[model samples]
Target: MKVFIPLLLGSFIFIGGLKEGFVFLFSLLFLLSLVAMIIGLIRPSLLKFSNRISAMKVLFPVFLASFLIVLITTDPVEEPRTDQETVQEDAVEQKETEETENAEEQSEEQKNKNEDENAAESKNKDNREEIHNEEKENANEESDSSSVNKQEEKQQNNTENKNDSKTLDEKESDPSNDESTNESTDSESDKRPSNETKGTTATVTRIVDGDTIGINLNGTIESVRLLLVDTPETVHPSLPVQAFGPEASSFAKKTLSGKKVQVEYDGPKRDKYGRLLAYLWVDGKNFNEMLLREGLARLAYVYDPPYTHMSSFTKAQSEAVNAKRGIWSIEGYVQSDGFNAVESETETKQSNNSSTASTETKTSGSSAYNGPYNPQGKDRNCGDFDRQKNAQAFFEAAGGPEQDPHRLDRDGDGAVCESLS
Candidate 1:
């Protein structure tokens, strides 16, 4: 019974170890126990003691209980997979890997396209800015060009106006037409003085001298000699520059140059030299009287009768004479005929004495009835007399043919004051 019990436990243990996938050591232990049980059954005397009734009976039940406990606690093994199912799973994994690769490629391509678009947009923006700046620069350049053109046109117009004014002056002063007009006017003025007191407006274009200016009369530039006033000979052809001449010219330039004035006509319209004879009024004040009042001019050229402003001009001259200003400052400088070039008595004596013998010889034949003639008095010139016959009479009285002290006959023709009307 003991041997049978041990043998049954070993068989159940070995089968349970293999079926439950237990360790090889448990199978080896089951085999060893089975061998031992067989040996014990076969040789009972080897296991028993001298006094033992049966040792197997005591150990066999314990071994059977241990094997039963091990068998009850073990789990069953799982079944293995088939080859076809494994192949299908590998195919599904490969397809998923390919889809993931395609998605990544699409994302990379979209990123590159976005970068290209952004680059193109930035380039376009830069181009637009450059074009806008260029346009602005061009506009500024055009504006500058337009301004330059306008300035040039304005300058050109001013130049043209000046040239036109000059041309008109030249045409009016032409010698061809002036001689006939002056001759006719001189004859008429000598017969009867014109009472034309009507005034006209004119602009002074240039200061010709202290008592003369070039005026723009209705777009025509005419040389205007201030009526009833004579400044020092600054621009005379045959005379030297007299004292205070430049001062008088400077005063005229300051007072009348570039100024609009009123031109009041007197007895004559023009002089023998074709210069217009008019009284200049500046700001409602008589410029001619102003010159005399300032001592820049002397009241002279009273050849014609009935001068309108003669009284006023004489008053202005009296003021300057009383003040002893300008020409009046010099003693014996202002005279009846004209200004004396020499102020020294010695020079005057030398001049008078040098021609004395010749003067006596020439005056012996002249029948002088006497129209204010003084041989040994103040110097006389052609400007002192009103007519040519009067000057001739004075020249004859002063022995002009042999010795001309006053130098009335500039051409040495023995015809005194031929320039006079």
Candidate 2:
């Protein structure tokens, strides 16, 4: 500890007139002083420099004063140093200070740079969101304009259709003026036959299904089915009849009983049923489109050319399903029927609670259309009715009750099926 003070004083003087030998001797003495201080601290009795403790304390103070005086007085007056070594030390210290200031400045600049970058990025993100919103707004405006135009066009068409219908009705109702009206209609039709195929020429001979009809083409009768649409059948003939089958058939009959239609073939001339599959034109409008717009049919084709009207068809179907129109109104189209054990547990609880239970229970939970009154029997308790759409479709395709490929009810309990019922 004593050496620290003396060494600092000597270092300043060492740069002056002090020789290397003198500096070395002074440094050695300072080192010895430190060793003595350490030894005194560790083992006070081992130190032999002073006798009495009072004398030693007083000696230390005196020695410290004398040492400071010697350092102050003995420094020989000499010329200031102009050596390369002195210049290098000053330069090194100045460079060090400059480096420290530069580091601090750099740290502050980096913090500001990060803040600016983040602000820019946040602004850019907000701009992108605003641009997206603007695009959406434009699209909505276009859609509204298109819808308004479509409505106006539809109203105009309806008016024209009603007028044409009335004209034909008037001509047919009055047999007296029928020849003159027919001659005028023929003249008008003849003028446009080359440009448009007149549907009135073809006479419908027989109705095949809701969508298909047999028409006298030239001389031979050709079976024509409307394209891009499907309708429920009284009996698939290819598949099977489903629920509301007769209603679907009746609706079709009422709509097209004696209507004239122009055919536009899209794909193969005929189906496996020898039916001409094409888009039908009625009153200059596509009947296939009418079925979809009326929510009476679903767009059935999924692949290839059918995709032309797929977007519009899908949109219409989505609207119908969302509105729960027609088949979509029927529950259990794609829902699941869970485990039987869980269902049985619930039924057992219900049975216990109910009083006056019937003796001829007949597996009351079973949905079997067996009895006379319950032709579509216990199956009516369709907790799983929501799943019937797909199930019914599959069953109809595989030949329902009459010719089912897999006898669903293996035990022959007068229940043709049981899996989902």
Candidate 3:
């Protein structure tokens, strides 16, 4: 019977795909059965059939609990990235690189062409000057001969041609004279690749976060990650929302949402995530620098080459940090490793007290959402019955389910203000 039982169980395990969880559960059961059988043999009087039944009743519940825990904690299998998607991404990157290189080559070729034209014009002018001088010498030495007169006429003709050539060159070089045509040319010059393409203007379709935004690039909508700035994480899948993240998101939405912006490429056109990397210019100001100056963002060190505004951005961040603005006001808000806001014991106690008051208000059937939600300030929390913007604010201030007995953080990644997030 024992031999047949194991054989039957082995067949069942194989049919179950022999998964690790199944194998572990089967092994535990098999060992327990063996131990029970041995104990019964060694002390038959102590472990009777009735005793065995009682023991199984206890063991079954423990076994079921263990199985449940394993099911809940085990990581699911991840799907593999498709080959087709990888190839497509690679092709796009290659095409963008080629276009940038072509622009640079074209600019260089244009410069060389202008230089050659100038050299040719100057050489022809020099030759005309030498001929005019020779004609003058002939006029001074000759006694009003017809050949001398013809030479003077030739000199006058050369002077007229030189003057006309100089005038045409000046007109071609000077664009300031024709205001209407200049305005039109200036508008198109944004996209034209000269020394560098002027910042291309685009309409902001959406603000993804404080440091990320969506802009309509020509006809296509592309994500643009801001250069030299990193705000707190409010929408990260793996990590919980950091303190002041919502404030940053809110600021970005208010300032940049649905606005037209100029996107200027600094280093590479696209980042590794296939998002366009650019500096955003709004109302003739650098938005990234403004965020730093306002103490809304920290300086990120993930810099690539040709970081033109790095020094200025670094200086702005220094000023913001020294001023103790926004997130910097919170204790232990480190710059290098994101916002690690460390609350002191007193602060924690105060926060807990506030949370308690808010909780009591909710439990006592008093409405916490009774007042107007003014989202203008930087450091607004959930306990402030003055304003409750959304569930995210409630969730963050409530400190989630563990801290927030109110269950405000539904998904529990510590994020609130869903509209801004």
Question: Compared with the true structure, what per-residue lDDT tens digits does model 1 show for residues 115-203?
Answer: 99999999999999999999999999999987875665555445432321111124245654344544444433223222244367888
Worst 10 residues of 2 by lDDT: 334-343
Model 1 lowest lDDT segment of ten: 160-169
**Residue 89 Cα positional deviation in candidate 1, in Å, after optimal superposition:** 99
List model 2 lDDT by residue over 1-421, tens digit each: 7999678567755765465435555555555655555665555567764444644464455545545545654557787787987999999999999999999999999999999999999999999999999999999999998797566555544543232111212333667444554444443322222224433345555555566665766666665767656665432322233333334455666665667766666544455334566665556655566565555666563322533344444445545656766544555331121111221343335433321132122224224332222222222232333454443443333334433222232222334334553
Candidate 1: pairs in clash: none
Q: Estimate each model's TM-score.
A: 0.36, 0.31, 0.37
In model 2, the Cα lDDT at residue 286 comes to: 59
lDDT of 3 by residue, 239-342 (tens): 34555565777888888888888888876566534567788877766788888877778766344444666545655655666687876666556445465646
What is the RMSD, in Å, between candidate 3 and the native fold over all Cα?
47.5
Of 2 and 3, the candidate ahead on TM-score is 3
| Model 1 whole-model lDDT (C-alpha atoms) | 0.66
> Over all chains combined, what TM-score does candidate 2 have?
0.31
